[model samples]
Target: MLPESHASPDRKRRPFLLLVLVLVALLGVGGYVAFQLGGDDRAPVANEPAPETDQPSTEAYQPWFAGYTDLTATPVFTFETPDSESGRDVVLSFIVAATTDACTPTWGTYYTLDEAVEGLDLDRRLARAEQLGGQVIVSFGGLLNDELSTGCTDPARLVAAYDEVIDRYGVSTIDLDIEGGNLRDTVAGERRAAAMATLQENRTAAGTDLAVWLTLPVSPAGMTEDGATAVSQMLEAGVDLAGVNLMTMDYGASRADGDSMAEASIAALQSSHRQLGMLYRLAGIELTAATLWTKIGATPMIGQNDVAGEIFSLADAAQFNAFAQENRIGRMSVWSLNRDQTCGSDYVDLTRVSNSCSGVDQGDQRFSDVLAQGFDSRPTSAAPIKTTEEAGQIGDLTDDPATSPYPIWTEGSTYLADTQVVWHRNVYQAKWWTLGDLPDAPVLNEWETPWTLIGPVD
Candidate 1:
């Protein structure tokens, strides 16, 4: 219930001040994962399982993966509960592990003098989130960092490194934010596609699923030639690419001087949908435009952008949020949750990068709150409250599958009041109509959700 013990009821309010908050935004769960610090330009050398024996490997895969799952679903809420400025309750945090180094993968925003603070104690924070049943998705290859494709040139080792991260974090979804040189590198792109294909196949064989999202820079017009090539590489390599998340802010050279940021974002997404469907046909996997829409996402820089004139204000976020809901897009995110704050009075420059806060007037969590409103489908981590009268009516439900009296507890499945079903080996009954939610996987938000888990079959 609210991740007991991490913070007191009256905890300090500095959003990224606490060490734990900074340390583990999207990093691994167990503890601080020590990485070999090398220059951002350094490509990975294939270190045999010999030297780094402790780093996850094929021989030790099972145990490490078990530890990862034990910690899954909970760490989704990356930051401390949103500050007062957070306009709405946060469901999922886009805990950006940016420009993540391809060599050793520091799994944090790579150090930048521009940032006010580099988050620390992330392992602890993530652990608390897991305990709370929040969720997190680790993003790789930010605009700043050398992508694994560029850094880890060797295909086998690249897959190994990616595999290690997948097992270590137990992340069901991972984002590859390919941009800049890495985005355009045709050779590296091929390697990335191949490695991901292998990784996806391996996970599926293990009875788990891995969703791979490609986050690329986009403009009001649409994906650049290179961007389209990058997506095509994955599809051609058979990487069951989950979605394409467009960076709808900082249109840079592509913006039509004075286009509305929201309009640009919508156009970018619309273009991506059409472009992606065409790619599917080329690969002989025919998906209609409606089907392709589900394979798309949007991530806007919450406030001011790197470009002087291009700003994605709160209004833009609201419009984009509504669009996402209307389209039923697969995912939605803010560029960096760390910067969700207002500029202090003395700090005049909004253009410069500041890690501690957003240069805009979001007042901490406001951007998250406003954009995330009505996104009520997120699985909760809050504990349930019980009452005497209703508790007396509890009873065991049936033991049939999805085809039985009640359909199975599938994600996005809606149920009316008093609907019942079975999940895993457990029985569940919907207290009210609900849909697009897990059966509270971690059982963190027991009091909420229409589906109530009634324990395993006798």
Candidate 2:
């Protein structure tokens, strides 16, 4: 159901405000073509020179989820906090990775579960947790690894493999984090659609609920052609797709001041919502906006991302949760739990992959903590104020802070044009009447905003 905040007749759906939160406006038809040609999320933006890879990575979390994945044996982590396993709604990540066996999908870490040995038994641990009334959602495929569909090419074998994973775990929901190569593979994608359609049919006949979610790369502009095609194939195959969980991290984007991850994510999800509606219509299915939004999920890589400049900070997570609560998104997830930690002073590999540590400063489960804020209930408040400040002021706007009388730039407070305020030891003037934008933050849309940094207060 749509969150009560957006439930009223006067409210607008906040789909992009919550999910993926990776909004990038598409410029033209040419941009659209370029997007479709490259379905993989890692593709470099056209004319946007790739940031140098060798730069030292940022290592500090500044925190989400009480839910995390203990993917390895050496770390030996557990959800000891009350907010974690027993309290809030949680989705455990990643079930199986690429395998040589085409017909059978096996469990265990195909990637770093930390520096720990092969002794980590996720199944045993999860089973124990489940017994205590914990909810665990199994995810397949990963950004850095190959998935079953990529390896198991045959339609029959893929269906069996998928069923085995679900049946083995006794899970009703499953996520497919398709990226890199497999995401672009039209053949595998089609086969996956066929296999799932068949599986859904059989499950329906047996009175079992199998909700399938496709986790793919997304931007504010919307899904690339490849991503749209992915949904199209699934809809065409007659599969009742549960949702589209977007990987909102590592966008390689650095939003301008006044813009935020929340805004960006909202843009991306809104675009996806429109695209999905079109595809569904083409497939002889018409879904309402609210219904379409309920099928969107946001999965952000906590702390520092693989892309150097992008960092989803603790503050970002707070806004994200608030937005999600206000909008009632389908689900929220972080990357593997193994990486949520603070690296020691000696640990200098800032950008390298560390399964045990998130490469950001984090408490045991701080990320999970923030992520669990409103997992079960949607908010009843007003919609998230999208812009903080604009460029046009209606009154006498002064450049100096002492002469110009105004209040501190508080989030959600409305300021008229030419208004001045203090923020983060700096003074700023509103270009126009602005609300909900923070003076210290980056703006996703560079074209317009409410703030212009004046000068340091004397």
Candidate 3:
């Protein structure tokens, strides 16, 4: 989402009393008893064991707090504020291609990496946030501007651009918010998938984790065709995708007349879960329902969405958070931390979208407070735990016609769309007319081959 032109107003600090009430509401009576027994009113320490509850522990819940911070918003966001009431983990967003050089990354196409370090005081603030046990996940791409992969056609240059940002930021997790033309361009999608696959491989070989998440626009029905293709390209290129985070806002005509914002978001998430399950299966990996839930995330525009009549309120935030915790979604994020607070009386139009303040009534309630209710973990903690040895192992089993469910694929044969064949002990379906392209080709891009892997032989 693009920022509005209005200047930022004075910051309002959350009251300490509100924090205590939030803690009590989240921790229940058992926690209050423990607090009284301890004879101290200090907030619980980070990573401390939570008091016993009938529901699942915070550890079991996969909802980690990474509220998006519009780095280039007006008046700037003080993410490193020591006593800030917002959650510790912040998602510094929209690291897009530089206006001059597509291969060079810039923040919202406004400041170069070094320039941001100086002008935004980014490096020092980031260091201070880390000192306070806070981590940041850099998000690339947004509603506007060109994402690096779309602008940099050369695969090597694209990979280098991604590497530069990852290396510079020292971030293990990155979110690719593909939308608009970037999402629909099949060629760019292929290029991105290949580059990400290479980047992940390099990081894996170096004994470092590079968790990648695809943030795409979605509706209550589920991910659009282009959105699904974007994800398919990533998986087909061998990128161990961390998760699929749906932009659960701006439904427009997609939302039913009677549905609340929370209801619509939940429906979108539920549909996305099913869609992702099928996508994973097509990539020859089948995940359990619970495991697949962890591979999904939801992000709603906090308040006053670009689409008229769409406002995600505080009540909606609470309901959505409850659903996320219940299903153990991998991550939770809002449109921006910059807009978490309510607008002042100066704002003449509440309907007009603002970057500095949320155009809604927030009575001692920050969107971050409600959205990040039980998400106590960091973004890095969401990375899939795997050893280098396990990652290095590759299966080389052959397909046998006796055990296969379909006829063995042959290079000489031209296959039509929907034609299923067996290759290397896996089932694949042809997406279009093809000949000589290997179903098991060691191609980086999905468009390089005609076959789509359906699953391993059962």
The numbered model that scores best in TM-score is 3
Overall local distance difference test of candidate 1: 0.51
lDDT of each: 0.51, 0.53, 0.71
Tens digits of per-residue lDDT, candidate 3, 1-458, equal 44332332111000122223433453341000000001123221111111121222344344587878778877677888733545588888779998898989999888999999888889999999888888889988876678898889888888988998999989999988887777767788889999999999998889998989988877776677667778788888988888888878877776899999998888777666656665665566755545566678878887787677878899999999988877677788877788888889898798877878889999888888888877776777766443121111233456788888999988689889989988766678888998876775532224445777665576
Off by over 4 Å in 1: 1-103, 108-119, 363-365, 378-458
- 1 versus 3: better lDDT goes to: 3
**Who wins the lDDT comparison?**
3
Q: Give TM-scores for every candidate, taking all chains together and pairing residue i with residue i.
A: 0.60, 0.62, 0.73
- Residue-level error in angstroms, candidate 1, position 190: 0.8
- Residue 146 of model 1 has an lDDT of 63
Weakest ten-residue segment in model 2 by summed lDDT: 2-11
Off by over 4 Å in 2: 1-99, 108-119, 253-258, 345-353, 362-365, 377-458
Candidate 3: segments with Cα more than 4 A from true spot: 3-62, 82-86, 386-458
Candidate 2 residue-wise lDDT, 135-213, digit = tens = 5566665544456776777787788878877786677766666665656777777787888789888888897777677
Candidate 3: residue 381 Cα off by (Å): 1.6
Q: Local error of candidate 3 at 86, Å?
A: 4.2
